[model samples]
Target: MKKLAKACLLITAVLFAAPKVHAQISIGVTISANVAPPALPVYVQPACPTDGYLWVPGYWAYDNDSEDYYWVPGVWVAPPTPGYLWTPAYWGYAGGVYGFHAGYWGRHVGFYGGINYGYGYGGVGFGGGAWSGNTFRYNTAVVNVNTTVVHNTYVDKTVIVNNNVTVNNHNSFNGPGGVTAQPRPEEMAAMKEQHVPATSQQQSHERTASQDKSQFASVNHGKPNNAAMNKVGGSHFTPNGQKAPRNNNNNANNNAANNGHQNNDAAKQPNVQQDGHANNNAMKTTDAEKQDQQPAQQQQHVQQQQHNQQQQHVQQQQHNQQQQHSQQQHKQPQQQHKSAPKPHTEQKHEK
Candidate 1:
């Protein structure tokens, strides 16, 4: 009965808390109810698949029509800009309405309802890691980092308190009996600095999670089977509405094995062993394969004819050279005989 009264007071608080443009603004709000949102479910965080990607923890998103809270799985996303860190959105109780503050990418971390989103997001500020220019340094003490892939890493235990928000409670909102964390000085300053919205990858991941029936609080009762993913849009639903891995290496392996077996069987055939040459007509090709090779065969034949013509031209030139040499030799001998005879006959006549 006391819990019921407290829930009613919490709802009343949401109804009365004054609006702040400083708080997230929206046109038409619906998810707020007299009841508190479901408790945060416990799930293992998937290891960081690769670096330069920050982890966005999973959260419950409300659907007004069904009044159901859908679990958006945690995913690693590449930031829009270098040295920017992601501050996750959270549901806080305000104005008697549980409004959601959308997350953003900024130079520094902002207030996220002091919700203890583990892995460096320790309810106050992000202790997971920090960035140096385009290079992001991960806090090994907190984040589930893969060191082999991401080398620019550091281990730090130092923590700074930027938000004076009340702690030691699991309340999912800011109204009565919920989190009373007001944005501290640094968080407020961080908000004023340049801010970037969530990346397309993260938006797509949330959309996919929203469509999965198994991710709803009403369906899972607080725990989702798939709590995290290595990358955004990793989970796929087929056209038949069944969740299945897009690329199944096992199926591909089976197909390759089947093809190998078929090849072995074909090799044992007599016609194949003879390569269709038994009747001098073996190695018959398909009509399409033959058609594909016709142009190549024609090119090869043309090249061979060109080579033969070149050889013939060289042989003809050699033959002409030999005939010219023989004619020259015959003319030289005739000239020599004529010169010797003339000299001997003139001497005899004189005597």
Candidate 2:
């Protein structure tokens, strides 16, 4: 009993010591192989018109057994008690492994491991600031919903904050496999305060077995690392004789199509040159292959015809060169080759 209690204390201490360790869940490096995270359940908060309540965004959580990540969308949330603010859930990295911890209501907002939650949660700090008083003016661009959901205050559709959002579907080591950011001292202090886990509606009811499983199958295709998934993301040829560029870098995988265009431009010249060389070689090799398949008489005839054609082309080239040389010769001054010799010998002939 004492040993079990010691183990429990050690585990508790570990969790408290590194709050950022929770953000990471087990995920594979191959993007195509990455299972689509389950969609989080949506819940509505009872309206707190007193002026300090804030909305937390939903996000996808990773599941271990099924090997997939689940999506949990953000929601409208009430403060812990009164003066405390809500720190949005974010993924952070500690000692090379990423951990995911839920965001909660706190006395003051602290560092959130630079996680850019969609709809105005920039990587560093929450785009949504604290309540100045009983009035919190939401960024009109970021939050979206039926006007019915939010009634006590203003709703500006024009104010959007998730404009610079990226789909973070890389499944890479630093980015997705493990978490990479840690919380600051202030954030650690906030961890001990009272907070609420995702509410029932906030809980995504996504079932691994029941929900559509088609999306997970597509993530790992043609991905470089997973040899098994390579067949999925197969080599896609561009229109008009262009092939995708083969890059071994992670960034290239994310932006392969764009990089393919650049590579295609440079590849055009080489492809043309290669085609010319190939055609020349093909023409040469075809005669031999054809000869092997033909009757002896037919082969002789074909060889004779080819030889004649080659000779004719060579003669034509020579003729053209002669014409060019003649033209050049005419442009030069004329010379009297026999005049000087004639003068010496003509003394007898002229008389």
Candidate 2 lDDT, 255-283, residue by residue in tens: 22322212222222434663567666777
Per-residue lDDT tens digits for candidate 1, residues 1-351, read: 543554565456545556642243231122454456776655455667688989887777865445567777777888898888888777776545566667888888887877776667767678878888888888876676778899888877664233311123445555456666777788777867888888888887776666565666766787666667767866533222235454333232222232321232233354665334643344344566798899999999999999999999999999999999999999998887774444444444554
Whole-model lDDT for model 1 versus the true structure?
0.66
Cα deviation of 88, candidate 1, in Å:
0.9
RMSD of each: 14.7, 21.1
What pairs collide in candidate 1? Answer: 14-95, 14-96, 15-95, 15-96, 93-174, 276-282, 277-282
Q: Give the range where candidate 1 is weakest over 10 consecutive residues by summed lDDT.
A: 253-262
Please report how far candidate 1 places residue 303 from its true position, in Å. 51
Residue 4, candidate 1: alpha-carbon lDDT: 58
Q: How does each model score on TM-score?
A: 0.58, 0.37
The candidate 2 region of ten consecutive residues with least summed lDDT is: 223-232
**Once superposed on the true structure, which residue ranges of model 2 sit more than 4 Å away at CA?**
1-54, 75-84, 93-97, 132-136, 145-182, 204-351
* Stretches of model 1 off by over 4 angstroms after superposition: 1-34, 160-170, 235-351
